[model samples]
Target: MTAVGVQPSAVGRGDVVLRADGLSKRFGGLLAVQNVSFSQYDGEILAVIGPNGAGKTTLLNLLSGVYRPSSGRLHLLGRDVTQEPMEARCHAGLGRAFQIVRPFPEMTVHENVTVGALFGTRGTTLGQARERAYDLLERTGLAAHADKEAHELTLLQDKRLEVARALATQPRVLLLDEVMAGLRPGEAQEAVGLVRSVRDSGVSVLFIEHIMPVVRDLADRVVVMDQGQVLAEGTYHEVTANPQVVAAYLGTEEGLHA
Candidate 1:
């Protein structure tokens, strides 16, 4: 399925890695996502932003296969996956990091990441998964805490753990749901760098973020949503300057740039 009014490579970056075509989601009588569509380029960092209740998280859930779209389709790497389950999507190269960190309290940090490496893809033995998990812990700056239980980490460490676990899946595309939500300025900067490293490692990233500065720093392009649908899509500079996008922020663009 082709994205609405999008040429797939319309952003003039790498090849299209993720596409949403006329996507919609309904819970009971309410349409949480309404005919939204966009394309994310390979190796690019695309951000989704909107005001409260604009369906950003709902849209992310759809993309991550948490909620099946009531209508429309989703394609990953040019393959149709609208009917796929979350695990299927993961194998198809889709990974997701949630805003809330939910690590297993009884497992050590290494053990938690090992679970992801073990299950995210097929054919990996326990030994291989453990090795891969250790590599990820080092890559994510958690090597020093590898033996520590998940519940023992600070908020920032837990958040980093979420991203590390997702990366252990070796996904071609990563979906991040406000990974920066609770981070302090310094920690957020570190997370921003980690995300960049992920993109540099050849993963396309699609994220939902509330912090304007982080979006400006990380996103190559942005999709602005309002009232369950896309209001505009373009570069950070372009969307932030859009009059409709400005009005959607309660008639004040200041909040968006702040």
Candidate 2:
């Protein structure tokens, strides 16, 4: 299927890189997530879209090991990691970039990324991590800003730094929580290219996005969520055309073109 903004590469989906089966989370009286299930295949770019309080962040937290599901299971690269800690999950090939860009303010951009490369997957030497971090900085177009302190970069540069740091982990699946939330139109377009390049490099991507154009352009498949449950899932065109999805999320069939 053709994506709206950037055409997806001819990468065939292989084995499941990540799987969530019947996952749910409860917060006191609130059931934030309800039995969410989905699989991310190797080399795929998946988008999860929903309105406010739709449990998108909660599901992301579950996937990234920020919160263990109260029920169900999570598998990464064929191994059950439902009970794994955040660091354990990172070492097991899951990486996440949060909605906010929070870098070590005093550290150089390069040093910030180096931390991820060093501890991300384990066994990486300091020298090796530094080299890798430099490479990632180059890839993310932040090499020019490498020596600058994290607090010195602009919002877009900070966002790039966030992605670069996450990529430093060498994860099989990257979970991005609204990486484009604060970007200008041009910046968002640039960020989209970065994501495509990341997928081209063979890491599967799962993102939660509010921007319809971004999702339409980037997602190979869309999983629509509402009221803490999956409302529908399909190609951007297919799901946007779904009446249920239209009613719950898109508002109208014309919303698809929006």
Candidate 3:
């Protein structure tokens, strides 16, 4: 599909990098997520889209270890991490970038990334972490701003920094929560390119996005959610064509872009 005049690259499926089975989360009497399940293959860019309060954020939190599932199991790289803490999941090859870009304001761009490199994975020496940070800065196109304080960058740059820091963890899978939230059209296009580059580097990507066009252009497969459960799973065309999805999220065929 063409999006903003850009075509997505061909995706090659590989081993399952992440999987969720019968996942559920309970906040007292509320079932924020219920029996949600999906698999992300190596090198795939997967998008989860739904209306507000559809449990997308809750699902993200479960995957990233911010909240343990009240029921069900999570597997990362073939290991069970259902009960693992956030840091443990990071060590097990799960990286996450939030919708809100929160960089260490007092730290330089390079130093901020360096912090991720140092703590994300085990046995990384400070020297090695510094090297990795600089390399990530270049890969994320922040090399020119390496010495600048994190607070001095623009919104797009902050988004890039969020992604760069996540990549520094050397995760086999990356979870992004609405990374395009406040970006203008041009900046959103740039963010899309960055996400594509990240997938090209061999990391499986799973993201929750509300922008239909971005979901169409970036995702290899689309998973639709509503009322805390997966409503459908297929290509962008297939899911958008589903009548249930149309009523619950898209509103109508033409509303896909609205």
- Over the full model, what C-alpha lDDT does candidate 2 score relative to the true structure? 0.89
Sort every candidate by lDDT, greatest first.
3, 1, 2
Sequence-dependent TM-score of model 1: 0.95
Candidate 2 has its poorest 10 consecutive residues by lDDT at: 1-10
* Full-model lDDT for every candidate: 0.89, 0.89, 0.90
Q: Over 4 Å off in model 1, which ranges?
A: 1-4, 8-13, 250-253
* Candidate 2 deviant stretches above 4 angstroms: 1-13
Per-residue lDDT over 1-258 for candidate 2, one digit per residue giving the tens place of the 0 to 100 score: 232221222224666778788899999989999988887778899999988899999999999999999998888888789999999999988999988999999999999999999979678999999999999999999999999999999999999999999999999899999999988899999999999999999899999998899999999899889999988877988888778877887797566644
Worst 10 residues of 3 by lDDT: 1-10
Report residue 145 deviation for candidate 2 (angstroms): 0.7
**Which 10 consecutive positions of candidate 1 have the poorest summed lDDT?**
1-10
lDDT per residue for candidate 1 within 1-258, as digits (tens), equals 122365453322477888899999999999999999888887889999999999999999999888999999888888889999999999999999999999998899999999999989899999999999999999899999999999999999998899999998999999999999888999999999999998988888999998999999999988899999998888888888888888886367567656
Q: Tens-digit lDDT track for model 3 on 1-258?
A: 221111222224576778888899999999999998887778999999999999999999999999999999888887889999999999988999999989999899999999999989899999999999999999999999999999999999999999999999999899999999999989999999999999999888999998899999999998889999999988999889888999999997677885
Candidate 1: the clashing residue pairs are: none
Counted clashes in each candidate structure: 0, 1, 0
